[model samples]
Target: MGTGNTNWKKDFDKAVALHKKAINGDKQAAQKAYETLKNIKFQVNNHSLVEAYFGSSSALIARDSTDLTDKTNYAKRGMKALDQAIKLDGNNVEIRMLRGNVAYRLPEVYFKRTKTAIEDFQYLIKAFEGNNRDISKEQYYEILLKLGASYKTVGNSQRAEETWNKLLSLNNSKYKTLVEKAKSTGGE
Candidate 1:
């Protein structure tokens, strides 16, 4: 979260790397990514995605939060930023992906965000049909995976099976084992 770097993309990518680290249990990385993304949001011309990352960074912070009130507040703040990002650019691939994934991770009973995750994943799937160039194969795979899980979460096992089945044709050798596991385990 250094201010020495003037380039927004570099700062954003660094924060993204920190986010990845945070996901792998590096708790301090989450706070750094949050601050970095927040500052980079003001540095960029495209506010939607930067805002989306800012929001996702907040969710990452929420994951590491120990206090109940802080957790809820950060999660809510992140959701609001995500909603604003989507409103700014509903079809944006990155924004939808971030928001949807974050929503999916939050507790459904408390936040009731699974439905929102479903909607965003559904949008991402449809968007992929129009242009695969914008959505990487990994993203496409993740979208299908999460979409299927979201379907199952809402009690629609049939669609979940259908979605998981789609991953087999992905043809990516790197995820071969993971794909099989997702299909076999109902995306659990």
Candidate 2:
């Protein structure tokens, strides 16, 4: 058996940083980072590819293009990249979350992918419930909350209430107020 090194930590971290910057509203930084990252032809593994695709998608969304056609093209490119990433790593919670986040934000006339986002959140919940060691407590909580919100977005108030109640049972004091507010609004 041959042992080959396949460490993607550095590239993955850099991509994550860029994605965070994009999420934080620094479109220029994200565009630059995405361009730089995209030029790197080799990925050590599926995880690296997932991050690269996600970063690229974020950059596309962040890029400032005055023309509506240009903006739509960028979004289409981003969605395709994300879809490729998902195909490569279907069970990766982070990848699913990233796609779901983007899909959830897109307008109904454009993408109407809220159902996909809901499915991703539900998948994450099932993975967590299955005692998947890869998930952290924080990730679990975030997924739960997002799941509830997604339910509400689709007008499933009953399901949303049920999901929120499950989150409340987690007993995390820090999120009590937020959960209470969400519950009070019937998961709105």
Candidate 3:
């Protein structure tokens, strides 16, 4: 447990550093934090905490990366971290949500691992189902949108169309056209 605590402290320090860097307009700090967090894969049994850190660090890194190629690689690393966090804490809605989020952002052509994304979305939906009143429809809809996009990217036109229709049923008109277009274009 001493090592676990040490890892936690390290993560906390990195978070503090990231905040300081962002406050000082250090764009690279965020990216650095992501790499640092990735390296800290300290095997936390507490899934929620691990996932929370993973999501926060990944977001910072992904948001800071200027090059598309770099962003994709960083995002992929973030996804792996989040996935492991989820395995340790599969019951956390937030963890599953982060997984869906990372999966959604991965490149379609090169990182066309739609199956992984689909599993994450499935987990998110299952977790969400048990917490409907506690979670906002907007948040759930966002996952659905990303899941649909993932399906489209993997050439599952039917699943994408069905998911898009489900989103529309939830009154998410904002992404309806885009989803429909993707469905029609067979995800390009």
CA lDDT of each prediction against the hidden true structure: 0.83, 0.67, 0.66
Using lDDT as the measure, the top candidate is 1
lDDT of 3 by residue, 1-188 (tens): 22445656666576657745743557677656655554555544444545556565665566577888777766666666676776777767766665666566666576665677788787776667877554577777877877777887887768877887888887656777766776676653
Candidate 1, residue 123: lDDT: 87
By summed lDDT, which 10 consecutive residues of candidate 2 come out lowest? 1-10
Model 2: CA > 4 A from native: 1-13, 41-52, 59-71, 183-188
Provide C-alpha RMSD values for all models, in order. 4.1, 4.2, 4.9
Residue 136's lDDT in candidate 2: 85
Residue 94 accuracy (lDDT) in model 2? 73
> Residue 78, candidate 2: how far off, in angstroms?
2.0
Candidate 2 local lDDT, 1-188, one digit each (tens): 11133454466567667767777777775675566456443443344355435545553564566777767777666666667777777788777767776666665457666687788788877888999877788888877877787788778888887887888898998667877777677554
**What would the TM-score be for candidate 2 when compared with the true structure?**
0.74
Error of 2 at 77 (Å): 2.2
TM-score of each: 0.79, 0.74, 0.68
Q: Candidate 1: where is the Cα deviation over 4 Å?
A: 1-10, 40-46, 169-187
- Residues 133-174, model 1: lDDT tens digits: 788867888788788878877778898878877866777665
Model 1 gets an lDDT of: 0.83
